[model samples]
Target: MEGLTAQAAIVEAPGGEFTLAAVTIDPPGPEQVRVAIHACGVCHTDMVMRDGGLPIPFPVVLGHEGAGVVEAVGSAVEGIAPGDHVLLSFHSCGRCTACGDHQPGYCDEFVPRNFLGARTVGEGDIRRDGSAVGGNIFGQSAFATSALAHADNVVPIDPALPLALLAPLGCGIQTGAGTVMETLRLQPGQSIAVFGGGAVGLAAVMAARILGASRIAVLDLHPARLDLARDLGATETADAIERLSGPFDHIVDTTGVPALVERAIDLLAPRGTLALVGAYPPGGAISIDPAAVMSVGRRVVGVVEGGIDPRRFIPRLIDHYRAGELPLEKLVRTYRFAEIERAFAASSEGSVVKPVLVMPAVS
Candidate 1:
């Protein structure tokens, strides 16, 4: 069968710059769909992978937070059709026990399905110069004008909403909001301290406020991010956690810094929980006082993808946005496809909370 050729950003080596190139994408499989990507969000995870934080193979295409319109559907796909708008998320093996329990974040095949840079069953669906290329990073190598996505990993959204603005909801935004509303389950009138004022931290702040948290504190090194946090509903903002008194009902550490994790543990109130949602470097470790844990009845948990099913959670986030609660657009900044490097630079410098790459509209 004939293939579709499109523009994509490819990294040829660890810590290499992303270069634009023409790549060929095969037609959808029996259970896949083709998306004409409109926009994709720049994420810290992509940065990490680019810098060799993960053992990703070189010459790979890496992007996950994608939103676009359906171009075609596989013979077996259902409920999704051409002309529908959708957001792409992480992939999971539906047969795994974790996936059966609705916790695809912990799916047994997660590493193979999401981190391997190729689909589980096929050699790969992307090629360059008649050679195979990595395509299915997170089931949607969305740094291109088009991508092939599994039916299960695509979530339909309203076409009326800005596609570029909705891109981040697939990962970063959902991870933050879900950590606050789903993982920690912060109740109204409770307290929470988020130890980072970036996209994830600010998302938590919005969710905490929506849940009526009486006191929501945010700590970040950047004054601008702290100010943005305040505007996003943080009741307290500080340059350091030391400036904020905690003993909070819940403490969330979105910074993987070992020192910050220790401090977050110390700030948790008796019987309170500390949720860790940050990505740590390989083999990194943190020390905690075991006696304090026993005496205070504290709970420490590591959260993955906010412990939420994207199909259920993304819609709720959109609903919150519609209700004027999420205000996710405040954190977004758009860049043209050719400006992907500039977008990466802004994200690396902490200049933009979320940088979305907008592809040229396909006519």
Candidate 2:
């Protein structure tokens, strides 16, 4: 399938618009798989990359939360083949110590492999007018009708599930739920406070509810999102963290606001854990008193991709969705692939909790 033509949304410069263009996809390498993307979730991280918040280069394709069907597989690929349904997540080097320890999210080569926007520093797999275009962001660069992904970043899933609905499990949903279920390991009858009522925070709320949390409080500035948080199993919703009283057994901060993280530290109960899943801006820092944290035995841990292996955690989330425990419908809003700009707008305005872009079907 070398030199296959596909439609892709490309960002030509920092803070530039997403222009739909004809690009050519290269054949998969020995450890790569090509996917025909069905749906891709618009995440805040995508916006960050677009606005040059990260170190990724320009003229890049950016979409990490993608779900699709396998279009082709490389010679060395196993357990995945053409015609399989799959979810695309971040890339990780399988030989890293973190991967060997079952924590691929912390893989040593995470930055270059996932954020460099190319297979290597200067080479990209997709081309437009014979010039290399950045295409391997998150190992998938899936803002296109089709994408080439590393075998390790592609997780085959049950075909019965709707790709549009399951797209977010690749990133946002997994980060939120994984932080609660795996990182903090929240126990039943415990109390939790989730800061920021966006998709990630709302997901944490739902996970806490699934764990039988005694009290779940969600803090967000938007009333609509706060209301949605309540419907998703939050026992309390407030526009500000100050409005909620807490000695919370666990707290998840998805806002990435340094102030909110500082406030969350004070809310934790003794020996309680506070998981930070939101991405802070480059060189961002927060001030905290060591005495306060140590005196209460509070723990502050940073999490990436929920500190989980997608192969193991994504399927579990799917099962929860199947059982009616994770009500994804309440959070997702679909847009046609051509409406990519509008989808990003909706996500930025908080009008949509999770915006999924559906690709046009192949003729």
Candidate 3:
């Protein structure tokens, strides 16, 4: 296999605007596959990386929630072949203990592999004018029309489904829905309060409704999102967490706001659980009363990628979507790949829940 040229959205520096330019993509490594991306979802984490919230190298291509068709595979890859439809997820080292236990989200090399923008320091696969450009972000960096991904992060899916609609299942949707279905496992008749009625929170609302949760409350600053939350199965909606009466069986905080997290801990019912799914900047901290947690046996757990194996969980999510149980259409808005800036603006302004970039067809 030889290198291929593709157009990608690149950020030249911290807090930089994305520039669409032609770049050279390397062929698949022994344990990798190459994908011709059809669509990629814009996530808050992508904005976080853009604004220097993460310590990734610049001049990087960053898009993790991608869905596409496999174009090629390496010698060591199996079970996936050219023309297979697939969705990309976070990268994980298959040999790690967490991965051995089927929990790849907690892989030991997660930070270095997913955030550092390369497989190792100073080595990048994508290049421009012979200059190494940061790639391998989340192991796919599918912002490009093509991406190289680890075999572990690529899950083959049915070709009949719309890739644009299912793009977000790789990240935000999975995180939100998985937090409820896998992490908290909210039982029937239980109650849950989800903070931040964005894609993640709304996905949780849908999952909670599917699980038959008695009370599903969503809190968000935007009135429109709150209304959408109600329409998506949130039994209640509020602009502030305090306004919603709690003592809830489960609480999920997707805002990454320290103060809100602290407040949420106080509202957990006895022996209840709290799942933290948001990203906070490095060194972000919260003050918690140990006694408050100990007295009620409240549990707080940090979740990544909904604490799920995408290979398994993504298929289940597709099943729900097929049944019309998970209405992804309500949460997604598509844009042409060139409309990247407008997509970001829509996401930042809360005008769109999930903005998916549809790549131009290959000639």
Candidate 4:
């Protein structure tokens, strides 16, 4: 599949519309693999990249939560083969201290590896009209018919599972569940308050249930999303402005709002943990009461990708889904790859929970 032509959703400028157009994809470099993507999940992260929040160059292909089949493996890659089904997550340098310690999310080069437009170590592979376009937007750039992905970012999955439904396990789902299961390690009968009730928050709610948490509350402005959170194992739903006095063991702020963060910290119990997993715009800051934190021994921590290795954690998520414990399907809303603009609209309007873009059927 050398010199293959592919269609990708290209963002030409900040705030520009996504244009589905033909582009040239280079052969995989050594230690890379070429994937024929079956499905890609649209995330708020994609919107951030498109709107210049992370400041990558224009004309970039952006989609991180991707699931596909390996069509070509670079000579140096191993274990993964051309026919293997796979899910694409964030890229990390395997040799970093964080990676060596099994926390690739905290890799030293996270921003350069995933957010920067170019490949982490070499030249990018996407070209349009003979000029370079950002191809490695989270190492997969799977808003396309195919993507050139680093082998380190591609996690093989069971071929029997529906690739489309499993695409989101790469990011949003993993982040939420990982935050609850791995980061907080919420115990049975513990209490957790998850703010925002979006995909990440709902995933946390589901995870809290799986971990046997006794009190799980989800807050959101959208009544529908709060209801969905309740359906996904939230014990209670509340409005964003309605602050509850809580001695909660953990509070997760996925809203990324400074106000909500302050409230979440205020609600924490003695020795409680506050996990911040939301993405705020650059320069955003949250203020918490230092005296209270010191007095109560409250701990506030920022998390990335739920603080778990995707290779190990994603399979656990799949097992939860298979056992009907995760109920991730309740959060999905699918769209055609060509309908990415509409999908963005749906996401922005809060009309869909998690929009999955289905690529064109490969013959």
Q: lDDT tens digits, residues 1-363, model 4?
A: 457899999998999999999998888888888999999998888888888888676878999999999989887898899999999999888998999988999999888878886563543389888888887878889999999888888899889999988899999999999999999999999999998887888899999999999999888889899889888888888885465558799999887888888777778899999998988757877787899899979999999999999988998999998999977678898999989999999998898989999999998
Question: All candidates' lDDT scores?
Answer: 0.89, 0.90, 0.92, 0.89
TM-scores of all predicted structures: 0.98, 0.98, 0.98, 0.98
User: Which residue runs of candidate 2 sit more than 4 Å off their true CA positions?
Assistant: 118-124
Stretches off by above 4 angstroms in model 1 are 122-124
Which candidate leads in lDDT?
3
Task: Find the 10 residues in a row with the least total lDDT in model 2.
Answer: 115-124
What would the per-residue lDDT of candidate 3 be over residues 188-272, giving only the tens digit for each residue?
9999999998999999999999999999999999999999999999888889776989889999999988889999988899999
Greater lDDT among 2 and 3 belongs to: 3
Error of 1 at 229 (Å): 0.4
Local lDDT at 184 for model 1 = 90
* Model 3, CA-based lDDT: 0.92
C-alpha-based local distance difference test score of model 2: 0.90
Instruction: Indicate the residue-level lDDT of 41 in model 4.
Output: 94
- Deviation in angstroms for 248 in model 2? 0.2
Which 10 successive residues of model 4 have the least lDDT summed? Answer: 115-124
Displacement of residue 234 (Cα, Å) in model 4 is: 0.8
